[model samples]
Target: MSVLVVGASAAGLTTAEALRRKGFRDPITVLGAEYHRPYDRPPLSKQFLLGDWDETRTRLRPDTMLTALDAEFVLGDPAVALDGHTVHTTSGRSLTADHVVIATGLTPRRLPGPDLEGVHVLRTLDDAAALRRSLTPEVQVVVVGDGVLGAEIAATVCKLGLSVTLAGPQAALMEAQLGAVVGGLLGELHTAAGVELRLGVAVDGLTGVGGRVSGVRLANGDLLPADVVVVALGAAPATGWLEGSGLTVENGVVCDEYCRAADGVYAAGDVARWRAEDRLVRLENRTNATEQALCVAANILGERQPYRPIPYFWTDQFSTRLQVHGRPSADLTIAEGNIGERFVAHYRDAGRIVGVLGWNAPKQTRAHRQHLVRT
Candidate 1:
């Protein structure tokens, strides 16, 4: 059976590779919105932004590997709309397939404000390159968001010895994701790394002069001056083109447990929000991208397996590297090591371990993951 993948990033590429490995020798077409071939996105915030890695070094696959897949890659042309198993591109090209997979990923959310030169958001390679050219050790930078993307950008900028202020509504860094104890500790870490914290306030809007952003205005009538401003306010799923495609689209493209949105049509990665037993769930991490695609590929080949994976994510800031398995909560206790050093924190619910976090202690975290395996 012929297949069409409406994304060229991690999930889309993984799905094609999985399908090939599963012995499906049908024709495959991979569509990409960006001009660049599939590249790793995690490094865009840290390594690429810091100039530690160049553009070619960030590619997810080499030319030789892509050639071996033998799939036609239509780059620089974005899928503008979908009708059944047919996808229409911006170049007015229409292609139909027996099976269609949507792995369109996400688009970064921008703050609503006037058009300014210094304002930026990082989602694709072009965004990172544009932001990098403005970043210098001398310029005052302001990152508006307290989540993972904002925190990572702030940490990387501070490492360059640049003046940066993290503005957000959370009392501590990543409070919603890391909880009170770990989030408070992360706040201290950023402080130790020379990043100025402007927390507990909502951002009003952007203030600028001569069409260039000058500072970020907060709800409290305080303005934080900035020469370069990075808006890392998270992202939304890229499902706008599927609006009238007869697919259930809410926060994302809703699907069943098998990742099928409709017969002969499925979704994976950040774009796919599927039912997992009781509630609808969607994961935006790299691990889920691969796992969900694999499950989708298997189901497409008639295995009919459900996609139910325990969410996992990690982040590095300053000298600390954190790894989390399953869902962690604020009710945490020391499972191994100590708070001031490399330690493992266990999050329990109803006296049962639900998640495990390793603060610079990777081995201990894996050992504790067994406790949450049955969860």
Candidate 2:
């Protein structure tokens, strides 16, 4: 049997490798839109952008390791459409397989404006490299988002000695995930690190000069001067190719508990929205990408395993390492603590712990994760 994986990033690569590890030695083909090999994304906005790490360091696996999988890699050609069991690529190649795995991941949301020179979105390796090249000590950067990506970019650029302004419509940074209390603390952290926080502001458009982005125009008619603008406005699933493919496509490709989208078709990673608890969630983190890929591979191998994931994410900014495990809710009763100088917050839903957030407290946070797992 032939298996086709549409996407060559972390989720797709892991799925292909896991299939081999699970003793499925049938013909395997991996298709990637990008020409480069699969690389780690988390470092793109942090160490990679800061010049602390090179492009080679971002690779998920070395060439030698990937060669051992013995899968046919079709790079620089994206699957443009899906018809029955045949996948059509943008290069006009049609390949048929017994089973298909969709892991297209996400595409960054672009701002409504003409493509300016200094405006960038940090989702791909090339995007990070371009933004890094534009960064300078004298350059003033305005990041128009307060989410994790926006916050990380702002922090990285600030550490590079560039003046940065973080503007977003949210009342507090990461208010949806970390809650206002912890989110406000993060705002303080960014402010203390020389990042100007412009919260609760609506951006109208971008102002340009000589065909280059100059500043961010606010709805209230104020323009924030910017030498560079990074739009970390989140991303949308790259599932346009799956249109009319007889699969449920909501915000992402809706899948069953086993990550099955349709007969002989499965999905994993940021592109797969699976049933979790009573709701459907599409996780876009490195941990979920790897975990879901393995689960999908297992299910494909007839293990009949359900993808029950305990969501985990981490971020590094300045001198703080923020780690979180489990689903965090704003209404959860929080128990706060301080280990040495590190701050830790345990979120409890009812009497059972639902989530744990730690600021530079990895060990304690992991210990709390075990409790969450038991319950």
Candidate 3:
């Protein structure tokens, strides 16, 4: 059985590797929209932005290693359409396979303003490279959004001898992921790093001088001066291209608990929304990418296994490594550990462990996740 995987990022590449491990000898093809080799994205805003990596170090796999897998790599050609069992590429190529996996991931959300030269987003290697070239001590970088990506960018820019101003609608950094308590700690950390944070303030619009971002206007009649603006406004699943594909698309391409999609198609990573009991969950995490890909690979090779993975996520900011296990929603009661050298937080729903967070405490959080009662 032939397998055609669209997207060669973490989820798609992991799916192909898992398929090989399962001994699927049929022709396996991995298609990528980017011209460069598949690489890890989590480091794009951190180590990569800080110039700790070189071009040769950015690739996920060397040409020799990928060739050894016997998987055909179609670079720079994105799958444009899915007509039944056939995959149509943007480069006028068609590949027919018994199974198709959609792992298109997400695209960075653009802001409403004049097209500015210094405004950027950190999603791809090109984005990181552009931002890296402009990182100087004289540059005053303003980052939109207080999510993990924005926070990381703010932290890294500060380390690079650049002044960074973080703007977000949330009251604290990582409020949605780490809850209010840990988020408060993050706010202090950013402040300690000399990051000028403008939280709970929405940007009215961006001010540009000669098609370059100069400052951002706030709704409260405040204009924060900036030479460089990084729009880290989160990501939406890259499902717009699949609008007429007949697959359910809410926040992402909806898949079953087994990662099985419509017809002979499947989805994984940030682009996949799976049914987890009563809720349709889409976890945008690397852990989810690898585990769900393995599940998809197993089902593709005729193994009837389900993808019931506990949602886990991690974020590295400065000296802290915050790890999350399970879902954190409105229904859960958040219980946080006292702020100390190391942080640990737990989310309990109806007295059952539903989620846990640990800073530099992976083993503790892993053990805590084991005690979680899946409803």
Highest TM-score against the true fold, candidate: 1
- Tens-place lDDT per residue, model 2, 1-375, is 889999999999999999999899999999999999999899999999999999999999999988998999999999989998899999999989998999999999989978888999989999999999999769999999999999999999989988999999888999888888878878988999899999988788899989999999987888899999999999999999988788899999998888998988999999999987678889989999999999999988899988988898999888789998887777544445653358667777776778888888888777777767611
lDDT of 1 at 329: 80
Q: Tell me the tens digit of each residue's lDDT in model 1 across 1-375.
A: 899999999999999999999999989999999999999888999899988999999999999999999899999999999998999999999989999999999999989977899899999999999999999668999999999999999999998889999999999898988798998999999999899999999998999999999999999999999999999898999999997899999999999999999999999999999998888998889889999999999999999998878778888887789999988887899999989799999898888888889999988888988888522
Who wins the lDDT comparison?
1
Candidate 2 accuracy as TM-score: 0.96
TM-score of each: 0.98, 0.96, 0.96
75 in model 3: Cα distance from truth in Å? 0.5
Q: Stretches of candidate 2 above 4 Å error?
A: 332-336, 373-375
List clashing residue pairs in candidate 2. Answer: none
**Candidate 3 clash figure, as a count:** 0
As for candidate 1, its clashing pairs are: none
- Write out the backbone clash pairs for model 3: none
Ranking by TM-score: 1, 2, 3
lDDT of 3 by residue, 147-216 (tens): 9999999998988878889998898898887677777888998898899999998878899888888898
Question: Which 10-residue window of candidate 2 scores lowest in summed lDDT?
Answer: 332-341
